[model samples]
Target chain A: MGIYRSNRWLVRHVDVKVLRGQLVYIIGANGAGKTTTAKALLGLIPTDEGEIRRGPALKVGYVPQRLHINPTLPLTMRRLLRLTERYKNTEIDHAITAVGLQRLGNPFVSTLSGGEFQRLLLAQAMLSRPDLLLLDEPAQGVDAAGADKLHNIIDRIRIELGCGVLCISHDLQLAMDTGDDFLVLIPHEHDEMDST
Target chain B: MTLFDDFLIRSLIAGIGVALIAGPMGCFVVWRRLAYFGETIAHSALLGITVAVVFSFNFMLGVLISSIAVVVVMYYIDRSENLPTETLLGLLAHGGLAIGLVVLSFFPNMRMDLEALLFGDILAVSKTDLVVIWIGGGVVFASLLFLWRQLLTSTVSEDLAKVAGMRPDLTNLCFGLLMAIVIAGAVKIVGILLIVALLIIPAATARKFAISPEIMAALAGLIGVVGVIGGLGSSLYWDTPAGPSMVVTLMILFALSRVLKISYGTTEKSATRNK
Candidate 1:
């Protein structure tokens, strides 16, 4: 699949397939179309070339690169989960516990620490019991230790849910260590041809 | 019968109905930072009124048509161009207002009260105005209630909303149309200049104490009602302009809310420390 804007290609000639119970990480240099590939795969953006096909009855859960919650919007973590889909109290508790956030009491999403916020996002993704999970730079804004912890949680989630996982990251070495398979997106030879 | 015959009573009802719709819709506007967009649409109402007067069409229908047309045009421009939204809105807001004024100037024979149109004369609200306000307000209220969840999700994050099978584009289109309806319905009561103030101030005040979106919306509606009453009362007693009076009352409430927030924060901190 390829993505283009204004007669320029952002990503070209990319092929990726994610199977159940496997983790695939897409790693690249900054602006090498890592996020663009993920967005195109999820149908968030149109692909100018090639087609993307999903299995019948496929459900996708996505954790975006950056969640800029509006300050004026009053959304607690609990309410944020409900925004995606409704869940029972017990199910919400289970998901929260699964993500290892024990003392979470529905605090506003803005008030959470970086690590806690990533975990909260993980918990939200878990609520859907998705067939495929896509995470874009999930370790963004996190410390090294926090990133390790987040990756481990993601790995454990993939094992526990038995869902296909696709993650995008700029930290190639770090991603290679945790992922079962890796795809490196090299910048197009004529760099100026790429527009994100 | 005499009580029902009072124009003040009619104005009160009309103002309250408009407030009810404006309150909830305003929350979304504030949340999305669409105050300028709302202003642009409201400003276009002057042109709508001019067109209505020139062609002898229904005023509300003309306003709705013009505002929706503006919204559609804005949407396409936003999609096609890379221009900054603020610059575009600035051009449209002033451009629409200027053209409307110039057009109105050509028809000196028209028996139009420009002052009442620019700064609303709420006391002049007739019984038919009340009916229009209520019916339009009811439709807006019901649509908001139905689309509340999707709208809230879209405001939070459009990508996530799309992942959850909610169409942000469609939701926003509906939202823009609803805003047009409210502005068109409210132009007679608040006028174009002060319409955005009515949409924003009460929601801003409500944000201080609200713990949730629903509570914020409800509180905004209540605050709007208070502003209407206070403004109308002050206008009657002090011989002030009704629309400006209402906006002044809203500002006072916003100021009071700031004080309330500060005091409440201090008290809560102290109480927590004691505990």
Candidate 2:
């Protein structure tokens, strides 16, 4: 797929298929179209050339790179999860527990630490038991220990739920270490997929 | 004239109806940081009024057309050029107001009151206006309730909303449409200049005390209702302009809420420490 703006291609000739029970990483340097490719796959942005086909009854969850919770809007973690669709109390609690976040009692979203906030995003993403989970720089701002924990949770999700995972990574070594298959994105060039 | 001859009663009903719609829609405006956008649309309402007079059609229909037109034009202007939104809004807001006045000046025989149009003559509200306000309020209220989840989700994060299949684009359009409806219905009650204040002040004030989005919205509507009563009462006794008086009441409520938040905040801190 070629996603372009104003005669310049944001991402070109990208082909990725994520099957269930697999974890794939798209790793590249900055401005290398890693996030752009992810956005294209999620259908968030339009592509100029290729069509994206999804399996029947596909449920996708996305963890964005930056979530700016504006101070003007009053929101709790519980309320944030319910903003999209209503899940039962037990189910939300279970999702929160899975993400290893303590039960926060209606605290404003602005108060959470970087790691805690990432986990909150994970909890929200995992709530619907999505068939595919897309992570955009999931460990971008997280500390080392917190990143380890997050990866462990992600591994558990894949092994237990058999959901497909597609992550955008800037750290090539981390992608090599953890990802089942890796795609390297070079800016102004095509995608190169190499399965480890 | 079907129910009550008292213009005061009719004005009260119409003003309350405007407040109900403004309260919820205003929360959205505040949340999305669209206060100025709303003001721009409300300011363009003068052009809508001019159109109504020129075409000699239904006034509410004219207002809706102008408001929606401004929104569509803003969208295209935003996409076609890289100019900042603030500049575009300022250009349109004053541009619409000035052009409407200038055009109206061309026809000296038309019986349009500049003062009454800029600052509403709420006390002169007719029974038909009351009916329009209530019916419009019902439609806006119902649409808001129906789109509540999608609107709230999209406002929080458009990307997340899109992934969840909430269609943030469509929801955002619906939101803009609802704002136009409220602004159109509100023109008679608050006039063009003061309509945006009626929307934002109450919602901002309620934000000080609300713990959740729904509470904030509810309190905003409630505060608007109270502002309407206080303003209308002051206008009756003190002979103030009804629309500006209502805005003053809302600001006072906002100040009071800040004080309450400060005191209440300290108590909560102490209570949390005790826990």
- Residues forming the 10-long window of minimal summed lDDT in candidate 1 chain B: B266-275
lDDT of 2 by residue, B108-182 (tens): 889888777777878888777788788889999999999999999899899999998879878988888889999
What does candidate 1's lDDT look like per residue over B1-275, in tens digits?
A: 76648989988998999988898899999999999999999887888889999999878777888899888888889888789998888888889889988998999898778788877878988777778889989889999988988999889878888888889999999998999899988888878889999999999998777667887899999999888998899999998998999999999999998878856664211211100
- How well is each residue in A23-124 modelled by candidate 2, as lDDT tens digits? 999988899888888888888988888889899999998899899887778777777767778899888778778887756554566667888888889889
For residue B178, model 2's alpha carbon misses the true position, in angstroms, by: 1.0
How far residue A69's Cα lies from its native spot in candidate 2, in Å, is 1.9
Alpha-carbon error at B132 in model 1, in Å?
A: 1.0
The DockQ score of candidate 2 comes to 0.43
Candidate 1 C-alpha lDDT tens digits along A1-196: 8888777678987888899998988988888898889889888899998899898989999998888777676677777777766688788778878877867566767677878888888888878999899998889899998988888888888888999999888887876676788888988867555434
Q: Measured by TM-score, how close is model 2 to the native structure?
A: 0.93
